[model samples]
Target: MTTWKDFLVSASTDAEAQFDRLKNRLFSRLDAKKPYKIVYYRGFGSPTAVWITGRVLRERDLSTPSDNDTFWQNLLATYQRFESDEVPGVTVRVDAFGKSNTAVTDKEGYFEMTINPPDNLPPGRAWFPVRYSLDAIVQPTGEPVIKDGYLMISPLYSQFGIISDIDDTVLVTGATSLLQTARLTFLGNAYTRLPFAGVAAFYRALQSGPVTTLFNPIYFVSSSPWNLYDLLIDFFRIQGIPKGPILLRDLSFSPAILSSQSHHTHKLAMIRKVLDVNPQLPFVLIGDSGQQDPEIYTQVVRENPGRIRAIYIRDVSEDRRDEDVRELIRTAEAFDVPMLLVPDTVEAAEHAASLGLIDPDTIPEIRADRRADKE
Candidate 1:
């Protein structure tokens, strides 16, 4: 049991320490002439923890803050909710890298932080956590005020990339069933998302590896609608998935366009955009076998050859016949790119780590099912 003063005092102290740690971390990693911005997000629900996630942008060449045209802004409005007794406030602690700083949300549930580049701040990736408390009090129920959560800010480059898929890949909204899909698209909210088990653990494992590594440039290229971006982000945060750019398709596209266009093509286009900007680095691709991932990956392997080092496909429906699976196997063999088919992301990651793609001692086990061939 904790009192109001106990909550306030503890929260304030923690917030201050978190702020200072973030400020110092950023200052140590930024250059004086480079500008950057931080975006904060808060989740709403019963005793839900609020999180701040943002990327830092820096100019390649030394540019004054006044001359720098690019700055950070929210793609969607920040969200907040007040129970009968919750209160919110935000404070911007420092400003460098253009609009880099800290801010607390007001009663309306909005907050912004800006910063200017510091001369001593080095030129590399940097991150900081925004910690705070929510204050609430219940009358007869005796519920206390002030819940605690965090906001995370780290530097990101436009050249960084990510590749993901729809259906059973990112969100488990039932891509195979039209009725289920309609329900998910129409009535579903963030809570409706059912992330494949072990996805969060796998993502965190990948992020924990070496800096500026091969898979650093990441993105989520899904056939799912852009409308679900917020939901997906919240899902990833709750599940502890690494944050990066997310590319979503238009759910309202023309029938001809939607039918004629392969999701693989859209994903390839996104990958091309990332490669066009950063031509030197390879990419990481993640997808599922519920639809046309095998066909798409086959084409990608043929076109790019060695651009993709590894490909992981979740085996959801198990609809691919023996011949089709064999063909995909041959395609992967031709390029020397390791293509994995796993029951879920966990098993896929286990294969990846075993192949030295990630560093984790304990790997998830794949359940073996013994069945005789009838034919």
Candidate 2:
């Protein structure tokens, strides 16, 4: 009884419905299968809900990008980035010191809760442990599952701390170059990635230095989004960078600011937060010459006065930016904070050695690692 046009319309309607179903599935993928397993980011600050957060995702939806991934694998990784799954609207309970706090996940399947510690908490240990338990969920196939996760609390006690950038300063990310940066970001996974030569040993020496002692806290404050948290953690583990809180930019991907997400604002906000949290401890500012490190560190010195002991910026872009760096270096003379623009990791080590931030013997260790990496 239907005409050809009606048949075509019915078919078209069915296809649209199918597409809509697919889109909705992508949004609720983790929720439909399992209660999201919590992925915790290290939290700083204390006394108040020093703010703890982690993303929940289904196990199978997680992608570990490798530099050696084939074309298809890379494509899958790209999908993982754009179409990643998150747990949503579920309540999570966090337990610490016999007290519990509750929070509900966002549409992105992320949750945050600040468990209060006792009034007279001991600082003898660097880390205190907390337990997380998620509510049970039913999968489409009628399977039930429950997830448990743990978090560590870093207590503040160091004389001086180090806030370093990760992209170019610690890891050899091609951030200054758009094409190269995109290539490295999209194609490279944590395992396939590499660290800047001699950085690990240099940082370890600083951590174990006479100035700050063995447990000096190091905060890797990066402008990169939080989505790469696990990959960055693996990179640090492989490179032997000392364990510390890694504060990353929020990839909230908020529709309002996607067109103008300011990296400067994010990094600056984090640096200020860290400084504010540990008012008694001075910090060393470590960044690179690539983007805004020199400028930002200059501002920090100007604003905080004597709080920053030194600024060490690795010279990753010497050819075109020597004059720019020299200008920043010269300008730093106006402030009490010393700034060192080093040509190589060894040079930075030497400066730190001279300043007593690290041992003099660290210079030789850095040289050896540099030689080994070259070979």
lDDT of each: 0.49, 0.72
Please report the candidate that would top TM-score against the real structure.
2
**TM-score attained by model 1:** 0.54
lDDT by residue for model 1 over 155-264, one digit each (tens)?
A: 23322233567567866777767898766555444444466766655655555442324335355666665445556666677645677656555333233224446566
Q: Candidate 2's C-alpha lDDT?
A: 0.72
Segments of candidate 2 deviating more than 4 angstroms: 1-22, 25-31, 46-49, 59-75, 113-115, 135-157, 211-213, 252-261, 318-320
- Among all windows of 10 consecutive residues in model 1, the one with the lowest summed lDDT is 78-87
**Regions more than 4 Å wrong, model 1:** 1-122, 126-162, 210-215, 253-256, 320-322, 362-375
Candidate 2 lDDT, 1-375, residue by residue in tens: 987755665666666557546755765653564434566777555534355677666645456555566867765664565454556777777666678787888866778765566766677555656666666655456554344433433455555788999989998888989998777777777776778888888888877775535566688888787777877887888778888888876554333224233677778888997787667778888999998888888878878888888889988885878788778777776876789988778988888788878879778888988777566
Number of the top-ranking candidate, with lDDT as the measure: 2
